[model samples]
Target: MGNKSSSQPPMKWPQMPWTDRLLLSLVTRLRDVTCHHNGTVNRRLFPFLDHCTAANPNPVEGVCTSDITIDSSCNLYVRVFMPSDPSIQGRPIPVIVYFHGGGFSFFSSSSPPYDALCRRISREICAVVVSVDYRLAPEHKYPAAYDDGINVLRFLDSDRLGSIETVTDLQLDFGNCFLAGDSAGGNIVHHVARRWAASTRDWKKVQLAGAILLQPFFGGEERTESDIRLDGAPIISMERADWAWKSFLPEGANRNHEAAHVFDSIKAGIEEAFPPALVVVGGFDPLHDWQLRYYEALKEKGKEVRLVEYPDAIHAFYLFPKHNDNTKLMEEMKGFVQANRSI
Candidate 1:
């Protein structure tokens, strides 16, 4: 574990553009930015800000985006993006299964920001991006999202995905599939990857290549240095996180629940089956220590783990294009996918 002390050396934080600084200041004023009320989300109240975007199959410059239903029973769907970049068109492309972050209770895969992020990944990483639209909480609760995550994997391995028109013509390399998410979605990636590793289904075509977790939402019963010091910081706070946990976790479950605190309950054997992992940590994120803990836990279990740190980053810095770290992240991700892809 890294040092969890009160006093630390001064580290340079990223300089945000003026507009981003104003937006951050404004967001801090909200009780909880993503419409948390009465233990459930009220998307209607913030419809303008939290609006969804319809998927379009029509190619726009270098890529194409469309929606595919995964499971109608649970209202699960995914926004699929295929790269049309000249360099990638002729070759078989890797697939990335993405989950969006909204503290678990909010944000769908089709949310405008998430949609935009996936498009860039598809174009720059030269891979197909399947951003999963899992059910949310205070209603669906824990395991619902995790279950949805794994179900998407199953769908990819099955015959159904191949028949979809948007994906049919494109050469998708499922054998090199990677799971990625940020914040709460990052938490989901861990559980889903672990579950897939344990599944008895001997996958002959689909292989879990790598897990890309960006500042994964993780917690414990006790607070760490980042949690204590970064409290009330813009974007994320301890109070808001606690409420999210209360809303998402099963009734009466605390922060130490298996979903939130992964370091304690990990059993043997899963690590060997688990794919190589790349965990990204932001120096300014309150969850920094927890993300580090995740990397350390994986390393301790004899798993191949890579930790990428941005000393000047805040939580979800990848969302806004104004931050230079966001650009760096894309390049880092592009490199990871290229290096970890199946032969």
Candidate 2:
């Protein structure tokens, strides 16, 4: 945790319109009902949520969908979204392999927010968006999800494989690739980035444009003041986060493992030849301070980095298109991608 300042404003949710408030209440009710009966959500929720997203369409153009299988058994599925028109000609378009957030235990590729956001990013950034549906916890734990993430990238960058089910066949500009994720997915992106950095030969063939982390969860045993303050906030509570973390890690595995927390172990290596990074955090999120620390560490290494903090936002604010701040964040992301197009 970073040093606290008394001058920092207290974290709290800002006022919302009645309609938005009602929708949030309904979502909470539905989430509680589903969790109560099923214990946790299954992959089926993805298609259903996709339908919801399709109904409430956003201002995105060119939406193409396909699945990629990381493992041969076809158990693991990775969904992808590509722009209708080729955004980059003569070269493979820059690709963003996105990992969806659900504490690494909940949600699927079909979640409304995930589907809509993936489509929006594809259209907004004009890059192919690959959403990895890595195996979840209790049944499959740490390193499993991480391994699947690495394999997915390997498969996409492969030139030999004729075709693979569950994985897409889109031509990718492997040289200009970016790893991105939210929440637990953010943790996966960070892990993959470290691995990519270490495996220079493999990653060198492909340019790692940068990493975009949205409310990443870099875990540690000790709780920061922000975590203590936002212990029971709506959307993502501390208790839920704790449960998710425990569920993701294997039995008796230290939560602070280099592969688990990442920042501590890979900080030095990350500082050396790391790709540029953009980290976005909600001002009211418990992980805000941690994101700031990560940003500072990258800057200390003289790495190109950008940080955006939304003052009136909470965790997962970017997933909610209804929020004005969320819309602005999308625009900012588009500009960031445009300006940072890998050379």
The lDDT per prediction is 0.82, 0.70
Q: Which residues of candidate 2, in runs, are more than 4 Å off? A: 1-12, 18-61, 86-91, 160-171, 203-205
TM-score of model number 2: 0.83
lDDT of 1 by residue, 1-343 (tens): 3443557645555689997786556444333655555677665655666567778777775778878888888889888988766666556889899999988877788776788889898888988898999998878998899999988888888878765534636778888999999999999999999888887366656788899999999998788989877774667878778888888999989999999999876644454678899999988998999999999888888889899999888988887768878888999999999999867
For residue 55, what is the lDDT in candidate 2? 22
Query: Pairs clashing in candidate 1?
Result: none
Q: Which residue ranges in model 1 land beyond 4 Å of their true spot? A: 1-14, 22-38, 165-168, 267-269
Which numbered prediction scores highest in lDDT against the true structure? Answer: 1
Q: Which 10-residue window in model 2 sums to the lowest lDDT?
A: 50-59
Over the stretch 1-343, how does candidate 2's per-residue lDDT look in tens digits? 4444679686557877776676556544444434422234454554443344332222245677765556768387767786766435445567788998877776667666688788888877878787888887746877888888887777766753345312334566667778889988888887887777777676434557788889887767767777877755666665666666677776776657665566666555663546788889887888777777777877776789899888777787767667768778778777776677765
